[model samples]
Target: MFTENATLMLYVENVQAEYDFWKTAGFEILSKETIMDYDTFDMKPHADSTLTFKVYDKAFIKQISPEVADFQPSVLFETEEITELHERISGLTDNISPITSTPFVSFNFASPSGIYFAVKEK
Candidate 1:
C-alpha cells in the first residue's frame, strides 16, 4: 500500500469569507472543486502541498458534538507574502492584527468560524 498527503481541510461557516481571509493571510489560490456533498476551494503556495477550506450545509455540522470553542486551531502557513496578506485581511476582520518580530514577521486572525490562524514569512 502507498499513501500520500492530499490536503488540509477545514470546515468553515462562510466559504467565500474564509477564502478571502486566507488570501489576506498570504496563501495563493490553488484550485476550486465541488463534490456531490459540498463545495470546496483550496489555496496554497506550492505544488506539493495544499490547504483547503470547505463550506457545506447545516448537515455538515449535524453531529459535531463538541463545542467549537473547544476545537483547537488546525494549521499555520509560512510565507514571504505576509505583508500583502496582512493588509488584505486586516481590513476585512476586526480580529486580524500584526505581531512583533519573532522567528518570522507574522500576523494572526480568525476565520469566519472563529478558527484562529497565524501567518509568518518563512
Candidate 2:
C-alpha cells in the first residue's frame, strides 16, 4: 500500500523563475541540476519535510514523454498561520485571492508559472 507522499512532479516553462518564487515563499532547495539539456530542481518546505516537489522544464518532458507534459496536479497545502502566510506571499503576485471564510479560512496563490494552489488553515 502507499504510505505517504514523497515527491510530486511539476512541469513548467521556466525553471529559474519558479526556483526564485518557491525560494522567496520559504521553500528550501534540495538539489538543482542540468539534466538532458534542461534545468531541474528538487525542493521542499524544509529539511525534514516528507514531501518533495521535483521541478522540470516542459520542453524536456515533452521530449521524453509528450503525452504527460501538460498534466498539472492540484495541490492543497495546510498551514497553522493562514493569514500570515497569505500576507507574506501577497507581494509576490497579484493573482492571489484574499483569505476567504465561506467554507474555511483559505487562500489561493499562483506561482510564476501560472499554476494555482491552495493553502488552508490546519
Candidate 3:
C-alpha cells in the first residue's frame, strides 16, 4: 500500500535553473540538499505531494543506466486560473505549446533542462 507522501523526481542538467523556474512558478521549496553526489531540491507542488529535482553527472548516469539520461516524465499541475498561469509560464519560457481545447483546456511547457509539464484546469 502507498501513502499520500508521494514525490516525483526529475533529473536535470542544471539544478539551480530548474529550481528557480519551479520557484518562480509559485512552487514552494521545502528543502535542498546534496546526497550521494546528486544535488536534490524538494519542492511542494501541493500540500501532500512533493516534486524533486535532482542534478547528476550525465556521463555517470549514462554509465550506470543509459536509459535514465533520456527519461522525461509528463507531469501535470492542476490550476483554477489557467489563463493566469499560462501567462506567467509563457513569460518565463518560450517552450510552451499553445493552449488546446479538445477535451479540456490545457497546455504543456518545458523547463530550462527540457522537461515538459502540463497545467490543466481543475
Candidate 4:
C-alpha cells in the first residue's frame, strides 16, 4: 500500500499567482520547472519537509483530465504556533477567517482562486 506522500498537487487557475501566494505566505520553494511545457512549482512547509506541494495550472490538468479540472483538495496544516502563523499570514491575504476554536484553535484562509485551506494547532 502507498504510505508516504512525497507531494500533493494543487491545480489552480493561475499558477504564478498561487505560487506567489504560498511564497509570500512563507512556504519554502523547492524548485520551479516546466512539465509538459507547463509551469509547475514544488514547495513544502519547510526546508526539510518530506511532503511537497506541487502547484500546476488548472488548464493543463483540464487538458489531461477534463473531469478533475475543478477538483480542489481540503488541505489542513498543523502548526505549533497557530496564532503566530495566522497573524503573519493575515498580512498577506484579506480573505482570511478569524481564529475560532470549535475543538482546536484554528482558522481558514483562501487562495487567489478562492480555494480555502485550514490551519490548526498541532
Candidate 5:
C-alpha cells in the first residue's frame, strides 16, 4: 500500500540551477536539505506530489549510467492557461517544441538542466 505523499528524485549536474528553473517556472519550494554532502531541493508543482533534485557529478553519473546523461524523462503537467504558460516558458528556455495536438493540445520543453517535461491543456 502506498501513501498519498510521493516524491520523484532527479539527479542533476547542478541542483541549484535545476531548483531555480523549477522555482521560476512556478513550482513551489517545499524544503531544502543536505544529503550525502550534496544539496537537495524539494519542490512541488502541485500539492499531490513532490519533486526533488540532488546534485551529482556528470562524469560520475556517466560512468555509472551512461544512458542517464542522454535520457530525457517526460513529466506531464496539466495547465488551465496552456498558451500563456507555454509562451512564458518559451522566452526562458529554447528547448521548447512547437505545440502539437493529437488527443489534445500539448507541448514539451526542457529545463535548464535538460530535463524534459510535457504540459497539456486541462
Candidate 6:
C-alpha cells in the first residue's frame, strides 16, 4: 500500500519566473532558496501546503533527470466562482480561456508562465 501522496516537481530555466507564475495563479509559496552566483533555485514546502511547485536549474536536472523529469506542473482549484476566477485570470493573461463544463463544472486557463489549470466547483 502507498504510504503517502506525491508532489509535482519541475526543472526550470528560470526560477523566479516560475515561482511568480504560481503566485499569480493563487498558490502560496511555502519556502524557497537561491544561490546568488549560480542562479540555482531550491524550494521546500510546509506539510500542509495544498499546492507546491519547485523550480531548479539544468545542472540540478543532470543529477535527477534519469528518475525525474522536466515536466510542467498543473493544479486544479475547487471553487464556487469558476466563472469569475476564469474571467479575472484571463483579463491579466491572454492564455486564459472561458469555462468548459463536462462531467464536472469547471473553467480552464493558463498561467503567465504557461502552466495550464482548471477550476471546478466542489
- For TM-score, the strongest prediction is 2
Pick by lDDT: 5 or 6, better one: 5
Error of 2 at 97 (Å): 0.3
Candidate 5: minimum summed lDDT over ten consecutive residues — where?
A: 49-58
Q: Return model 4's CA RMSD, one decimal.
A: 1.5
RMSD of 1: 3.9
> Candidate 1: worst 10 consecutive residues by lDDT?
50-59
The C-alpha stretches of model 2 lying farther than 4 A from their native spots are 1-5
By lDDT, the candidates rank as 2, 4, 3, 5, 1, 6
In the range 1-122, model 2's lDDT, one tens digit per residue, is 98776899999999999999999999999999999889999999777788999999999999999999999989999989888899889978888998999798899999989999999999
Candidate 5, residues 2-120, lDDT tens digits: the string is 76566665767787788777788887787887655666677778665444434354545566678775554557888989988998888779999888888799999988777788999
Among these predictions, the greatest lDDT belongs to 2
The residue pairs that clash in candidate 6, if any, are none
TM-score of 3: 0.82
TM-score of 5: 0.78
lDDT of 3 by residue, 1-122 (tens): 97645666577788878788888988878888865666667788655554443445454466667877777777788889999999999988999988888688999999898888888888
**Sliding window of 10 residues with minimal summed lDDT for model 3:** 50-59
Model 4, residue 59: C-alpha shift (Å) = 0.6
lDDT of each: 0.63, 0.93, 0.77, 0.89, 0.75, 0.61
> Which parts of model 1 have CA positions greater than 4 angstroms off?
1-4, 20-38, 45-58, 63-72
**Ranking of predictions according to TM-score:** 2, 4, 3, 5, 6, 1
**What is candidate 4's lDDT per residue for 21-69, written digit by digit as tens?**
8998889988999989899999999887878988889889989998988
Q: Is 2 or 4 the stronger prediction by TM-score?
A: 2
Full-model lDDT, candidate 2? 0.93
How far does residue 14 in candidate 4 sit from its true spot (Å)?
A: 1.0
* Local accuracy of candidate 1 as per-residue lDDT tens digits, 1-122: 63554555466666667666667655677766665564567776455563444443233444454344234445677777677767777777888777658766877887776878787777
In order, what is each prediction's RMSD in angstroms?
3.9, 1.3, 2.4, 1.5, 3.2, 3.9
- Which should have the higher lDDT, number 1 or number 4? 4
**lDDT comparing candidate 6 with the true structure:** 0.61
Please list all clashing residue pairs in model 1, or write none if there are none: 24-85
